[model samples]
Target chain A: MSRNIRILGTGKYLPSKIVTSEELDRKLGLKEGWAAKKSGVKIRHVVDGEVNSDMAVKAIEQALKNANMTKEDLHCIISTSASFDQPLPCQASLIKEKMVFKNHPIPAFDIDSTCLGFVVGLDTISYLVEAERYKNVVIVSSEISSLAINPNQHESYTLFGDGACAVIISKSSKEETSSIKTSLIETYPEGVHMTEVRGGGSILHSRHYSEKNKTEYLFDMDGRAIFRLSSRLINGFMERLFKDSGLTIQDIDMVIPHQASAMAMKLMRKKLDVPEEKFMSIIENHGNVISASIPMALHEAIVQNRIKRGDKVLLLGTSAGLSLGGLVFEY
Target chain B: MSRNIRILGTGKYLPSKIVTSEELDRKLGLKEGWAAKKSGVKIRHVVDGEVNSDMAVKAIEQALKNANMTKEDLHCIISTSASFDQPLPCQASLIKEKMVFKNHPIPAFDIDSTCLGFVVGLDTISYLVEAERYKNVVIVSSEISSLAINPNQHESYTLFGDGACAVIISKSSKEETSSIKTSLIETYPEGVHMTEVRGGGSILHSRHYSEKNKTEYLFDMDGRAIFRLSSRLINGFMERLFKDSGLTIQDIDMVIPHQASAMAMKLMRKKLDVPEEKFMSIIENHGNVISASIPMALHEAIVQNRIKRGDKVLLLGTSAGLSLGGLVFEY
Candidate 1:
């Protein structure tokens, strides 16, 4: 029998600070409705003094509660994030420590793939669980993109929020109720340079900083190019995913794309010919939470009764690495 | 029948610039033999203008040649590293562009767990291959640790080197003479703070350049604590590994430990009761290459005829994440 990795629980945490597009426009000297109409974003949540680990912990706590699981039940914890609290020990270690799971000594670490990180991590967990190497896995996607955004940089500052989401994947042999039925990950390296953070990291250290040289270490992006690429890749990936799984678009009850720009999501919907009701998006309120976008949206969708048990949900994401991935799950 | 993931090819790339411990001492005000006697590091490579992607491309090129495979043969490429060029798009995507493979798009991304990255990456690939999700996989572990080192910080400066290693894994069911037998990964979150880079990440980004900042965002380590933890974990893991594999120490031909420090290796060897001749240390020439250390040493061992075609080689590593992992492979 083929072992299936099922998501037993799902949870998300978004900071309470809400900044409206008008407020952002006034703060950054932009025209009214510019942020909303251009990106389909009305507001975004910004965390106060909340790091990636903090957000991840919140999400994980809620997820465990929902799953009725203790830390000891987890065999592995894989946390994915673009923003890290430290460069040496991964952010997951911090979460492991804070949660006081030290006694279990569960293997935990951070996985990164920009915005597609969570999907990749989820797939990795699925593989491990199916191989019987791990019984219970906790995959957390958390980001404090606001910390990397330069408030002075109008483009990125208005487009990123702070949030985290967690999914508890368990090994199961049942056919119909499995959480992750199938997953596909694909990368288009040619589009990597279109979006990125130019500074920071070992490539550009703080020691290289000079009083006169105020480098923009903040997130930098080519909005127009990303839009075009996102539309093409998102649609292409969805088509291939459905085909590979021997399913049709009509079989998918919900589509959760990365909560990046409102325009990109709309473009994807139009290109894929999927109805707006079939798509779930949280970008209007949360902006781009990077890896956390899809799962966070899933959490909201579940809460709002947009999805029900046995629903086939397509979780898709695309990011600066010019990377894209999707997972079809029966929830 | 269980499918096995076999290493079809292996390749490594060292920067052209080599710096002897004496040379590094002259530049950093350290004793000449301190690195060699204490850390078993005689010389280490340094990348000048080249970055992680450059080394990755070079290693992947050689790996392809050795495997007699083109980029199209690969279904997935997983890059593992601690020192990345940027925080977005992932280093794997950059390497994918260089290959320019014409076929179905291959999934690629980066995995980080400090020095244990390579072992964990291989384990992940093994699980994915066994699941029959991917047929051909390439795992690369590369680091530009020098980029993170503060030349003036004598402690971290003496311990790091830049290098890259790549291994191509493919699905094989043949009864091979030697192959990746088994592997185990463990993480001790309580010990994460024993060694770390205090700056450049989200935690210190705010106070990175502040005068009040005591930690310089450079690599900081509590060597004594790490020694204790390393010895305990490495010894304990090897015991369990050997028992699980039903192999004795005498059956193992060679033991390759992460090229961290000579003292740690010696202590571990003593605890494990392994003969000195059965162990190999490349730190004498490569220092601590972090994630790249084991593969680089394995490559050197293979070239030097220290390991035979069917030799049982044990690879182990531990790092700042307080993470440790091991793999048993047939040479």
Candidate 2:
């Protein structure tokens, strides 16, 4: 019999500073309720000095504690983050060093799939465990979206928050009691340009930077295009995921779409014909944490008693790579 | 029974411009044979206007052609590159958009494990195929190391290159014979800082750029430290890989270590007690293409008849992520 990889625990960490619509409106000269109504974000967490790795460490610690596992028990550590502290050592290496796992010698690295990174990491870990290459893996998705956000760019600034989420996945002998039974992934490259950080990579190195091009260094977004694509793709991906898993929407006790915008989630709910109660949304408190959004939502759902043992949960996410993915798990 | 993932084809592309040691010595006021003796590189391919994505496209196209499979046949595309065109909308997405795949909508994204990226990507594809999640997967590793090179720094500039390499992996079936079998991945985050690009990421964005700190933006290396780690780890990894595969080093037809430096490979060969004739080196022509080195070496071996169908091949690589991995395959 084939072994199954399961999510043993979930954890999330959000910045303490919460920026309300009124505060942002005052700072950005926007009308009250405008940001709230359009993005369905009354407030969003923003990191002060904390970096992506810092947030990831917090989430991983919580996840390990919840799983009753220690760093020594981990065979792999896969971190996914778009806003990295550095380009050379990889954010994963930094986390490994900071956590002092030098003697453990476990393989740790980072995966970049834009916003769908966490799901991709999760899927990759599941594959490894199923292949019997590893016994335990820790997947962390951390993003300080606020660092990339252009304060002057209202569209992006009001929509992003700083946060991270993580889950410990391990090989389980009790196949019937596992969380993640299967995962399906899909991507559409046509939507790649809908959202992006226009600078800071090899494409726009420091040599190209000038005072006149300050705006180009910050995150940019085609809000309308992303919203339209997200609404269409999320529904299509969820449907395909259900078909792939041989499970119907009715079988899912909860649906956690990436918390990009409240409008996008509502549209997905309507398309999937699932009630709002079945869908979990953390946008009001954390905004869109990119790759961490779904896991953050899942963590919240579990704490709120929205998910229980044997309950089927569906996770769907989409991002700048025009990437979309879904995973089904029974907790 | 477990499924086996095998390599279907391999292809590589090098930049058109080649910088000979004579020219480099004159430019840097270095003694003749200095670079050749230190890094074993006599000439290095340098990118002109071409970027990582461009080279990857060429390799991917050739790999598909070699496999007699259309882009539509691929279910996933994973590109590994240290030099990315942008921070968002990963380089992998660009390839998916440019490649006409008969509307199959294959999932594509980037994975960054530095020099070990290609091996990591191959391992990922193996797991995906083993889980029956994907039938046809393409792994591409391309790097334009010149973009990160500090031309004034002769210590590092003369020992790098620009190139891309790709491999098509598929699930082995009764109708199709296996070529390359399985891969092993190991990472040592403790060694991450042995080589790195100190600037241009989120930690020190363009906002911090200054002429006085120009060197900060270029790739830096602790050559001696990396040499020590590479030599030690490559041999250890190879031994474990052969043991896991139930094979002996004498059974391998070729060894393709990352073309970081010739001395590193020589030391590793000595440690493994492998014959010089069984190992391949491309640093003499292409320098260190970072993530692209291993595949570029493998491509050359295949072209030179050093590797053949059912011949066991070993790939070992180490990079800034302080990430190191090894894979054993029968091709």
Candidate 3:
């Protein structure tokens, strides 16, 4: 199906508290510059006690303000958070409640794909806008990775941040040049267990808590295995993505990748042959913000004028589901 | 902006164990028949260590068999669980992993709206199928509430079960009468705290498990408050739903509602003026299976020859987001 989407506005928010690598070194009892050397993060914004919805509402407000729109102008809110504020009512409902300004019973739900959620949300909601079911839609991705961090797992712990992002979009008209060129999302579920938080779910019931079994509750990962599996598939996957659109990697204006880890992004760019200048990264200060990574980077790209109207922006990411998602869209 | 969908088949799976009210009466130290009197559940299937994806794959297999199709025929799988197997990779990826026969890299994701998830999944995926982004889409809602049940909260605990339901759907051709007519979903975030599981997300931090804070890890609900809030809005919501379709109560052939609770279903039928036979009920035997409730009931209605081709079937439910969703589609 052919569909077009106009980026009305993009906005992002980070937690107020900043944690530097020096602070992490002191906290984790690591050597000076050791944390930065390993994670490639100098400083990261981490939430102290703020709820996910608090950061989320701020981002949504900025997006609406940027577009000169209001909550009343939205038809539905799609919350695409990897981690959540609460699990029961879904993230979107909590977000809507926090967004009290001019808030009505606008329909809300959640699309969860871990880190690659932003790309999927944009691709999924475009069909609704194109079908005319919604005139104006807001896609918000909020992640509180700081709370999810396992201080014991310093390897993955230092490489995380907390943030939220919102993108306001509408259907493009025939005269508009903005449109999604092509997209692909594929999951290799065999690698599902490589990186995950085992608690807070039915399989690893939270009620079955004990001091001996604490590791299951924290973030667990076989980082090398995940990278090995992802690397095997990405080359062919990227080829098919551009091939389907009758375009090449060099044809893209800019690349916005999931700020997964400093090393992963570097490896991905090298493997895909994307130039260092062409790849967008906020990992130096932001670390990996989970599902908010792509949109947060996109928002930064937009404000910096690195990507203007009619720019072909490539969004690519590998998520917890061992999912590889990529999209080339006109911004 | 028109879309049509044809249901090729529907299937359901129950756990291996059946927990009768008589058994619950003994287990909970209640008087004989007291459990059934309060919960209106004679028997309910509750999972006994079987994983969510295990039951989900079984349901999917049945659905595919009913349509004489294979997993390879599907372009995507949408897992719409109210509760999840895990909190990390999303429910759909885990399900895809379980359905290994003929499995390939089919795009998978989750649409979460608590108990109304099945309705939301069907409604949301329709836009994609109609746009020809996917030729065949399977929506599976697998929930295991038994493990999350708090033994102390008998009121909400007894009114739950575990099961999975899958529906195989495709785009309807021009001559087919099977089409989604009108759908409405609205969330009133004011009632967000009425029903929820406090643990398992970034907010309730699963790692903070302690003896003094055990209740936070289990399913918690303010049943009366939720009912009161839902009642205040449903009458108007139902009116708007049918009004949008230019139809009234009598136009519906079968009313398959979310098996939330026996009392809730009874109250809903009375408020909406739906006839006794038109309303389908499985709460007596199956109880409330969360997101699987509506589709499990729909699967029963189809196999029992209640909802037939050209029949106007209504799917309705109230969810944990304190959300209300309804849809009427021609079978």
Candidate 4:
């Protein structure tokens, strides 16, 4: 029989340097309150000297401590990132190196699906644990979005932040903990260009670096396009997701969603029929840390005691692939 | 009870332009036979204008045809790539977009573990299939190493190629079809930097590009270091893998190892005690295509009738994370 999977611990790390909407407005030469009015992000964390792996390691360390476990106890590591430190060895491998477990004979890899990367990682990990392939798995989302966006692009510059979140999932040692109910992940790649950085990989390269290719080398997106499409389709998406899972809006106690943008979050809250307090939104302070948004908000919610044992929680988000994903679980 | 996963069909695509050792030797101002002698690679495919997604889509189309199926039959898609077309929506998403699946609601993502990436994707697919999450899954690997590497770097320039491979895996329609037996994956991230491109991500950017960071922007590796470490540690690694699976060398009919380098391949063959014919190698003509090497060779091996039904084949490889992984299945 398959074993039950539970989220054992959650941890998040924000860079020390904080950049407020005022600072972003000044940098982008916008009027005061323009960024905040446009994106609903008041302040976001910006890294100084640290890289993606640095933030990832810190999140994992805290997650391990929260679980009352050590790095050696982890059977597998799955990292998700939109803003990677490098393309090769992967974020998980770098984290293992920094965690000082160079000889840890465990399976480690990275999953890239943009903002829904963490949800994708969670879905993958749930299956691994259910198969009894692993006992304890660490799912990490680290983003250095501040370094990825072009400072001149006011839209993305004011929306993205730098942060990391790590969550440990395992068989519940105590029977009281809740188990994962259902996870729904769907990708519509037709919207691939909706929000993207074309040069994030080999499509654009430094070898052919030129002044003309400057904007192409940074984060670019059709925010209005995504907003229009998501608003129209998300209602039906959520309806089917909940109906198929034998759940409804009333069954959910808290909704943790990817803090994509101010308008997107407000639209989702109204569509999902959740109260303001029930709808989690840490992005107003942390901004959008790509894949880390949902998990970081979930971690903060847990820390603030917004969720308790036996509560039903919902995690949902729309990602770069125009993907819409949701996970329903009891906490 | 868990279901059995089987490889239904495989396909590969090599770029039309072939760069022979002599051509590379002349380009690098080396002796005529320098590249062939140093890396044991005679010729490698070089792409002119094709992107990673283009190669991936072609490979997948061929694989689907070989499986006597079509794109709609696939329930999920997993892409393993070391060199990606872009970083945001993921290579899998890009492939989905290019494949004209404007609204195919399937789960798609990219797994990065360097050369072991395909193996990781296979492992994840196996669990998903066994759990009955999906009926048919496609794993595609596409690499544009020629474009990724620095032209001046002789070591990597001659040893890398541009290619793609796609395999369709699903539940066997026939009762007599072969099934997956066991899989083992291990990572030691201490060697993360041994094979990496420091500027491939946010660590360094084109916006801040400079002459001093030239080598960091392209693929670089300590080949000798990886060879020495892998050669020293593979014996114990294989021993544990085989012993845990309760299998001995005599049970295996073929070994499909990653074509990392001529030297690394030879060392792995000797260390594993596999016969010459049982160990497959296609790198002499194709060089290393990163994550696509194993699947591409497997496709060639099947076409050449190297193994038949009920035969045991072992897929094993060492990747950049100092990772050693293998899968044993009956084919």
Candidate 5:
């Protein structure tokens, strides 16, 4: 656990097109407002013409500006995405190509924990920063999940969006109090197949595709199964996380949970007993952006002054691994 | 840069079926021995009905047995795969499920650097082991790349095999000399598209599949482009790597290079001036197993007793990112 790393800046990028739930209701032939009522998503961003890496680069540029740093200052780029830009070369390499830092062969790679990518990236890279191997690093979670949405899977169809969120982080000075308290990510494989895309991998090669198996290539989820498994484990997972750092839920000044869904968020917040004002929510407009959810919500919280420097903040999320991840840090 | 981490054990698993070049000659209607002459592959393994994670778990089980430990001893599972089991929950989660270790909520994730995945996985996880965050970590690189090879593309079709390689690594005590001397991974994004699967991603969603764009779904490569770019950079890259570690190639007792292609391996070995006796080669039988190559080669080298404990070892490779990685560690 690296205790002296700090997040210098944060930024997010959402695709231009917005699809309101009412529009989805009309498109899917559901009753008016039914889509919004079912998914609790009012308007969610969707990509009309943008590619994933281009959107990731835009978010990186914004983060660079926020941190008052340029691409030249970065020691490495860790791209975190549940959905990738391409199937080969890894996502960070594609992002690095788009950044076009002519002579900088900055070390880059991908760390994916599905929706928990951003949190895991932070935890993994903090050790490197603490070791002083990388002085400044950019961790970006970018997802073009809308492409994986199967229109026929009505439950998940209206509950997703496309976006990218980025953060520039560096080693804090000895005098600065900025640091991560602790973070834990635990995968309970009991729910491994609870959410998945069955095609496009070795088990079911995408080239074998035909109209008969289109759903296999798209995102499929048993939302109730995930919620049931996660709810059964969330209490113990969080208890272990806080106990590891010797901190409690009350020590957290703000709770930044993955905006999985409006209902899921509300339920988790109430279950955790975090005050309403302290819990962050972006799902109403952003939908569940997969890995980008937590970071995007954190970016919004920072922009809105909900979390300040030295404030104790906690990021919590349940990802497709049926993974539970929580991180408590000082902003 | 973690100096005291030691590889406790290593293992590899090749699928049951071996496709010989002679068989390919008959199958593809090419001249006898033409496939062998061109691809330099005698025989290669291909999965019949096995899933990627099952192969990985088998390899991990072998590695654990070699280490005199069990799955219960693992602190984390870091799965490295250029090709995945599935696109959703990640390869690690799937591997965990198959391990079936009840009550062990192992923290798991996926790290993909294309063919360089094994080297990158080791480098990244070394930090965690050094920090004592994880006492024992299993890093496995599994690839079922034969599924991605398009028989229509003669070059890549003859060049790939499928296999899994695994190693258990832990912290070395004060008396042990086992340590990583130095490692450097530099990604020159200039050649991002030199090799790729342009489909099954946001850019060309697999759902948009059709016979017209079928080629996009399979592995496509401009071999000359990658070789040309890599050759221009390898000397400087190796020079910097040895310079950083304050050691020359002469100090290394064994050299393990990625089984990219027999020609690539030969050219790289000759260019680096490594004696044939000290260089490791397994491409003849295994073919270019993508991400599983280096680790698979390393496992073979150790099994053959060509390198003893405490000997200096170097693992080097180039992947789809046009990324060059070099690691000199004490075995």
Candidate 6:
């Protein structure tokens, strides 16, 4: 029943428009160094004309190329995102359309668990591959954080960027396989309101939507509250994860934690007690791309030689579900 | 590698507000009998104050009760829907919150493929169960289509109803396994535009939402186009499905297909050569409940004593992915 679902390739796409912390501060009318000092984000990508699926398609294409495979090789496409280009048809379908995989009609869908989307997708696909239901499954986490963040919300506006990450998952050959050791996802719905877009759903139906209070539809985050709540359980959660996986912190090569915020990441790293050097951080340049953050960081770590073959990497993050999830694998 | 995933129980929730076609026709300023004659929907449930998660939780509770289980028995909760009460915390998370399952902290997420949402979830949970990842998973499809239908778009408005359907999937005992014979989902991204709500996603950013194109945010359907596109493939798709499952059309006791529309249902039944008695239809009483249509129909069939323990049942549907999917199993 256990099988190694290998990560064949990883790829990411960042927008062209780069917004520095100082620029964001100016836009939000905040003190000059307040933005950068509060959040470690120096510069982040902001989309202008591109959409969520556009970025996802680009990342997926790169993943396919990196895996040295073509569209024909993929048996399924799973898109993970909190920021959708549209609510209907699912973003995966849009990505499939944009990618021009018309000849290959695969099962495509979107899984949303807020920021833990990528990990949720990874966990789900790992099982699918393990079950031998699919051979080559493409998983993409794409986000347009800029579209969701309210500019008036100074704290959130300066800490979000638009980006996407994609990975191709398949059963490894007998000679080489990345053993996905353990995958765990737990959600405490009590934390659902820590981060939310109240007006963006059926609650704010189009029939009742008013131009007034338009900003309510944008993303809202109680950073301090989330940090306080998540920090309390993170240590215990990490312990459970390590215990369940039967691996100690010392066995991990690197930890790819969600770049939630500059402060949150620092605190989590300290609490998890992973060596500073062993933690992969990308928020300084990419800010928080929500679901894409983990995969984007993982992709960068591999490219920068922080993770290599035979390395044990743990992907971790907290999501809007008040969810904490991790995927431990040998790279 | 293949194993049976038994459906332990089935449940459905329909809003109390029943709007007859004549009432809808009057409200939409259409001629009497025009609405019912066109879509053959005599009545459909419309939510007054309840949201997607509200209905979903009710259905799930009923399902659990029907299965003679408690919340403690569920290892995971997967929700399927194109309509969300909100976009941030995933409907499954919201359901968890509303259902008072915060104590369990199980993995929760949402999968969306428009109307194919339920089928996709079924395919997914089956693999997960077959892989022994989870013992009992609750899959619910809750949709408030009444919130999305454009009153101005007569065709769509008359065809949608707010409802939810839930089922408990678990490992079947050796003596009672309801073998899931075949589960196939194919999405032709080419049809992503056939049915959609363009205004709810990043495409229609909240910041730029205009009241002028207000109706654009509601569900829009090109029924003729979807019928034409789906008709060309349903026969072939069903043939392939029967072939792969090692079954035949004659072997199936009943088919619970998505109640897309009365016209689409009749045409599909004729084209697929499924006898009128063999095709389970509920559009007249429930309309098209989007993702909940198939499950709701199946639940109704079970309640009406149409599906017995040893009968072969086929769940089929075409969704916004312009996707056609089918899952065959023995009750």
lDDT winner: 5
Instruction: Report how far off residue A145 is in candidate 1 (Å).
Output: 1.3
* Candidate 2 residue lDDT tens string, A1-331: 1236667787788879888977888888888777787778888888888877788888999998898888788888888877787777677887787777746767777787888888788777676786567788888888877666787778778888888898888776654576475677777767877887667665677677798887677788887887787676665666667664667889889998888788877877888889888999989878888888888998999889998878988888777878877778776
Alpha-carbon deviation at B148 in model 3, angstroms? 1.7
lDDT of 5 by residue, A117-222 (tens): 9999999888888888899999998888777888877778999999999999999998899999998989999899999999988878877777898889889999
lDDT of 6 by residue, A132-217 (tens): 77899999998997877887778888888899999999987788867888777889877888899888677886445566777678
Residue lDDT tens for model 2, B155-212: 6788888888998888787665554454656667667777888776656776788988
Candidate 3 colliding pairs = A200-B200
Worst window of 10 by summed lDDT in candidate 2 chain A: A1-10
Candidate 5 lDDT score at position B168: 97
Each candidate's DockQ: 0.63, 0.63, 0.77, 0.67, 0.83, 0.76
Over the true interface residues, superposed, what is the Cα RMSD of model 4? 2.0
> Which residue runs of candidate 3 sit more than 4 Å off their true CA positions?
A101-103, B101-103
Please provide, for model 1 over A91-112, each residue's C-alpha lDDT reduced to its tens digit, 9 standing for 90 to 100: 7887777777645767887777
Clashes of 3: 1
Q: What TM-score against the true fold does each predicted structure earn?
A: 0.95, 0.95, 0.97, 0.97, 0.98, 0.98
lDDT of 2 at A304: 92
List candidate 4 stretches off by more than 4 Å: A1-3, A173-177, B1-3
lDDT of every model, 2 decimals? 0.78, 0.78, 0.87, 0.84, 0.89, 0.87
Write out the backbone clash pairs for model 1: A310-A331, A321-B89, B199-B217
lDDT of 3 by residue, B109-200 (tens): 99999999999989998999887888899999999988878888888888998999999999998899788989889999888888888777
Task: Give the TM-score, chain B only, in order for the candidates.
Answer: 0.91, 0.93, 0.97, 0.96, 0.98, 0.97
- The candidate with the higher lDDT, 2 or 3, is 3
True contacts kept of each: 0.73, 0.72, 0.83, 0.75, 0.84, 0.85
Error of 1 at A154 (Å): 3.4
Q: For model 4, what is the error of residue B41's alpha carbon versus the real structure, in angstroms, after optimal superposition? A: 1.7
Model 6 misplaced stretches (Cα beyond 4 Å): A207-211
